[model samples]
Target chain A: MVETDMNSQAKADRKAGETVLVADDIKRHYEIPQGAFGKPRILKAVDGASFTLQRGQTLAVVGESGCGKSTLARVVTMIEPASGGSLRIGKTDVVNASRSQLAALRSKVQIVFQNPYGSLNPRQKIGAALEEPLLVNTNLSKKQREAKARAMMAEVGLRPEHYDRYPHMFSGGQRQRIAIARALMLDPSILVLDEPTSALDVSIQAQVLNLLRDIQKRYNLAYLFISHDLSVVRYIADEVMVMYLGHPVEQGSRDAIFASPQHPYTKALLSATPVADPEGKRERIVLTGELPSPIAPPPGCTFHPRCPMAADICKRLVPPVQRVCGTTSWCHRPWEAETESAA
Target chain B: MSLLEFTNLSVEFETLNGGFRAVDNVSLTVDPGEVVAIVGESGSGKSVSMLAVMGLLPWTAKVTADRLTFQGRDMLSMRPKEKRKIIGKDISMIFQEPTTSLNPCFTVGYQIIETLKKHTDLSRAERKNRAIELLRLVGIPAPERRVTAFPHQLSGGMNQRVMIAMAIACDPKLLIADEPTTALDVTIQAQILELLIKIKEENDMGLVLITHDMGVVAETADRVIVQYAGQQVEQQDVKGLFRDPHHPYTAALLAALPERATGDQLPSIPGVVPGQFDRPAGCLFSPRCSFVFDRCHKEQPTQAGKELGCALCHTPLVAGKPQNEAA
Candidate 1:
């Protein structure tokens, strides 16, 4: 079974820079019932997010809470179907995928959640937990499953003695490693990491991030990294998608996004993130007013209410996508000065 | 006189596995209008020390200090009645997890007013008016309607603002904010931090910021205390600490930050923090320290001189090199 799996993986690796996942204006909406008499109000958790994730690269979705980064993760991983738009995982269309196609897609795409404590079952031993995925998905024998699980444990830096230990016995970082090992049980091509290190300490987070980078290189896996942490995003992400109130306000390469943010929202977000260097010159654009309720989000470009450079037109009309310095920003007045671009 | 001071403070909690020393020997002093940040990972006892000062710890915990004073008044030996008078009135605290810290049974206004009623001699009308003003001061829009709103009605940021307002109701001389922005979004965190600083400046209050984020410590703290497994690993001014960390643990922690990474892989510290049972016999950080030696594993080191950022290491780092190592 392992040999067959390797052959299939080698066959799939024929093309370099293969696009593993392509999300075209994927959206997820939740309708809240307003009593028996009133109409149901629509909550646009994820409005229109479009991006393509390549093999052996990371595309990070960054936003504050309620900005639908998690919702987008669910959509991409096919855990929750998008209310609109399309998602293609290598050639399989997610919108109309049959049972067998979905089963195949599930093995190809796996997710590691934020809270390792809640994600794992306390009663389940590490070995059994890792093998359960194989038990359900593949026809491998029990011994073969145990061998694969043990190999994965070693790959993730877990000790051989820790195989029979319960989840409760392991620390947070160790549990997260277990979670990552479980996600890789089927040798997924695309991994969805939704705030994977947010719950961890800085030191532990570093270890996990290094592990992720190592695993990504070894497996040549494409990663859909979802997080609100810009610093972490700046480190791991090849491309960045900045979301605001379920809208992709800015989308560009990591350098372009970090060095020269075109959108005002992106600029505010960058400035708001406190730099580790105290001597670093930072022009803080402290945005006033909290995020507007997504249920009754302001008309036009939902960010107009809090935008420092907001004009009359900005409040009345949604801004069209403007491309500048290899970055796309949905704003009426994007910083287009060529001098601001990074060398 | 210093706004707050702690000399050789220690906190031990009575757990199932005997006495667990949550906070080791920690010495700190905070002047009025100073921001002192206690930075460490979870189980590092950054919060416990501050909680010891606030007298908020459970009865099972034993708190000891050679000198624990607030404005020259010894807090360690103060009577319960006297301590209560000074706690909410002079030295207030904003707890972590605003959602859980706030009482769901009462309105935000009622809560703020309750604090005022306990600390001040204000009338009912004046208390209500003060509550609204406090809400408005914290950047909560439509303060009039928000005062009547319950904790559930407000967002996490707004609830945090309310918590701040409650803490500063009586204009505390020393404010202890324990992981205030941990539960908040970055934008909201920025706002809350700005608000705290603004409040601290206006009131000339000594602020004790207990958090783990290096970015936050760099941006906000005047002085920083780096804790590792209940021990004061290092203490220095924010700028110097970031520029030249004198402790290996401090250096490793700062290097572990993603923003500070020079390459693809971050220089991470190996192994988790020593828990109650698995604690090392000598140095608490020795097992994980990159420059660990046989001496470090055998004998616990005392705090180094001020030149070394008061690092609790025998071979304190000087310009990233161990000072006591033989060539």
Candidate 2:
């Protein structure tokens, strides 16, 4: 059984292309029922969102809470199936794979959730929790899984003595390390991190992010890092995708997004971030009115309601990326010698 | 004298695990209209410290302080009636989640009106007018009609604004906002912080902002108090703390934060936060501090000096070295 799992992983590694994950126009909608029985309105949590994760690169998807960032991560990791659109991982089309095929795909991508306290089962020992993934994915003997789980625990910077401790015994940062180990039990090529260190302390947050970066470089892994923290995103993301109401408002390299953003929403978000620099003098743009509900987003562009540069056309049509500047060129205005526009 | 002074404040709670000190011997002072941010991690006692000052802790909790004098009044031994009178009327509070803090059964107007009516002998029409004025003051639009709306009808940001409006209904001298904008979006959080700063200045109200984000302190705080593991590691003016943090913990904290402008990749502190079970006798930050020497492990450093030199520093001051050197 151990031999079979090893052989499969080896073959899978070879078969897997450099681009580990591809999410094409992914849509994850849920029918949230209102009232007794009338028509149940659909919530397009991931409304036609699309991005790709290449080997050794971090694709940070950032947005405010309730902007469907977690929903997008769930779909990318295949925890919750997409309502529409396609998701391909390592040349394998997983959007509609069979039961066995999906199971195989699960081993290829794994997710590290937000709360370390909630993710691990308190009933199970640290060793047992880490062993569960190996037990499910590989046809390994109990003893083999136990040994592998111990090694994986060590891989995440946990001591071997911590194997028998309960989840409550560890600090938030250590528990996050344990969660990372559990996710790596199957040696996944892609990791979908959903605010993995949000619950940890600032000093500890740095350690966890550093550990993730080290691991990513060591394994040549693709990361779909989802977080609302702009500072964290700036640190780890190679490329960034800004989402508003489940739609990709901007997609570009990290340097591009931080240096000069074209989207007004992105600009506001960047300006809104609180920096420790006493010298930072970027004028903050406080958008009037609340973020429109995802259930029934504003027509035309999702950001038109809050955009300072909003024009008549912005309120009538959805904005699409027309070019790439620093990150992926994202803009609603036409690209030419210079098409004058805002919003 | 400061507008509000808290000296040697400590909070303890009993649990199945045993008695744990939620807040250590912490001391701070908020001058009139100054924003003093108490910042640290989840269990850093920032929230508990402020709650103890407000006398809002549950029955299970115990509080002790050598001095908790607000405007020269003994806060620790004040009569329940006296404390109650001062709390809403002179020193109001705000929490992180507004929905839970706000009474959902009543309109925002009623909540503010209750606060007003409890303290002032005002008529219903006057209270309603004041409520509308407050709602508008906190950046909530169309406050005249919105005051009648329930808390559920408002957005998170607006609800927070309503919460702030209710807090400042009586023009409290001291405003204690505990993680007030932690749950809000970044843009909303910025606006709320800005509003807090504006209101503090306009009203000349002393502000105590408790949060985990160091960046928030750097942006909004006139003074900064950094707590860790229920102990105050450092306290200084915001400029001094940012420019030349005396404590190594404060330095590490400043270093840990990722700067959007600085080209340097963020440098994370090593190791995890210490749990209650493993809190050693010495400095709470010794395990994470990069420059820890013999004294940090062997002997605990006391809160050294009274004002400008209050932090526990291992490195001796070098002769002729500049004082306000940037890290």
Candidate 3:
């Protein structure tokens, strides 16, 4: 019976190249009111970001803190509506969708937070936590929900006996496993993983990464992987989008971005990340100064104050999007231009 | 003489279930102008051993050591007042969380001045100037204005800079930074690490860096010590330890890095670290070790010679293979 279920699920898998999510000029802004006498100020958290995700592929969004990566995740999962632009998920126009339509769309996209210890309810048992989604979303009976939750637990490497245990009884790694299991219970097509392994040990991180990859392959799921660790992004991301202060500075294939980073910020980010190899000798380009305040970002380019090769034009005007060697960059003087001139 | 010498240090905490050894037989030495790193996962007791050195552990912790000295001065037998004089003056520490480590109620300048008042004879005017100078040395822009700002007013990186300024306010001879940059971003981490190394060199201070990041270890450390389950498993120079780790746990941990992976599947070590109750009688890592033998499950292993990284294993690995298996 289990073998037939596996065969049927394999047959039911979606086409590998189908586009599951598309975002165009997505923006999430917050307006802070400064007392009733003063004017309201608009803070652009995520501004003019666009990307597409296909089945069985991972598109990682990499940035430092307060860069709006988490805000982007919230917008994509329909937890909050975007302030502007369009988002289309599997032919459903999410921006203009009705309430009933949104209720159905929410289940199609699921998110796993960074900290497992906080995300789970302490008083709730593992079985109830897994079944809560099915109960609220579907009309499945108690017996059916229990069967499905147990299957998911087994799939995520939890034992049958662990079904009755509380979350505090589990270790960090096991808690993360349970979190992943809970996210997968809805059979979502898109998964937004926000620093899923940042709080875990290296050994446990490897295990979770392997499990994510396996689940992605098995279900042909689209993954919007978000992380600040560039090494983990380099390993898991098929395409990488580098964001700085609410702007997409660079976007390209993983190999292209890692090998020949055109944007100054991207180069600095790659260099700042310390490689584990002691023998590998590479020039380090440490960017000076912290991220500028997003509320009142730099006049022109958000990264001009920290760019190593910033020209006078960079400080006066925003750089237009330019494509070079299969990578898109927002920079006035990309390294490729200098290299090409030298050549 | 070494700047700091710690021999056979152990810390056992009294819990409801009796005694739990958090640090077992850990020995470390630091000469001036050297950086030694203690690398381990959480609960590996890397921070506890350093806390024990500073006499900062709680009263419930039972600390025992054969010899704990600093620059030929005995630290273990010193009175509380004498130890206090040396701890914050000659030996300072920077904690992992910069925001929480600082007092939120006071201005950053006041915090730095407080440190100076305790350890230096400078007058009020001179101490204020010194505080601004220290902040400038740590690369904080407009130090004059930043000194007046409270801890909650500055960013995380800025607060960390303030913390560094306070830690180095007295010109300490030895600095113990416990995961100082773990709470920071990569770009900020780079800035903080560069600032730390610069300060260490300028002061000629011995530095002890406790972290779980192998990348940071490779970039900064002169010597590396790998700890597991409160025990020191291997000790070697930074290059040698990364290139050819002699302990199975160390090898597996290096393999687990995402940057070191060659394929999709990382060669992860199986199972979790042993707790107090579930700790094995023999090798603490035997349950998760790949090359475990029958003897490993029965008897504890002793430390090997220096060539083998002083690995705590009966069959220490050499170039990824067991050395005693061939014999």
Q: Which is the leading candidate under lDDT?
A: 3
Candidate closest to the true structure, highest DockQ: 1
Best by TM-score: 3
Q: Which structure is stronger by lDDT: 1 or 2?
A: 1
Which digits, one per residue and each the tens of the lDDT, describe model 2 over residues A1-343? 6655874676456432377777888999999888897789998898988788887889999998778899988888788999999888877788768898888888888999999999999999999999998877778889888888887877789999999999998888999999999888887888999999888878788888878988887677889999888989988888999988888888888988888776778888988888885545678888777778888888898888888877788888776666656554344652331335332
Clashes of each: 0, 6, 0
Q: List the residue pairs that clash in candidate 1.
A: none
User: lDDT of candidate 1 vs native?
Assistant: 0.92
| Residue A9, model 2, lDDT | 74
Provide the DockQ value for model 2: 0.58
The DockQ ranking, best first, is 1, 3, 2
lDDT for B28 in candidate 3 is 97
Residue B197 displacement in candidate 2 (angstroms): 1.4
- Over B1-327, each residue of candidate 3 has an lDDT whose tens digit, in order, gives 999998999999999999999999999999999999999988899999999999999999999999999999999889999999999899999998989999999999999999999999999999999999999999999999999999999989999899889999999999999999988899999999999999899889999999999999999999999999999999999999999999999999999999999987888888898988899989998999999998889999999999999999989999999988643
Candidate number 2, chain A TM-score: 0.91
- Which stretch of 10 consecutive residues in model 3 chain B shows the poorest summed lDDT? B318-327
RMSD (CA, Å), each prediction: 2.1, 3.7, 1.5
TM-scores computed on chain B for all candidates: 0.98, 0.91, 0.98
Ranking of models by TM-score: 3, 1, 2
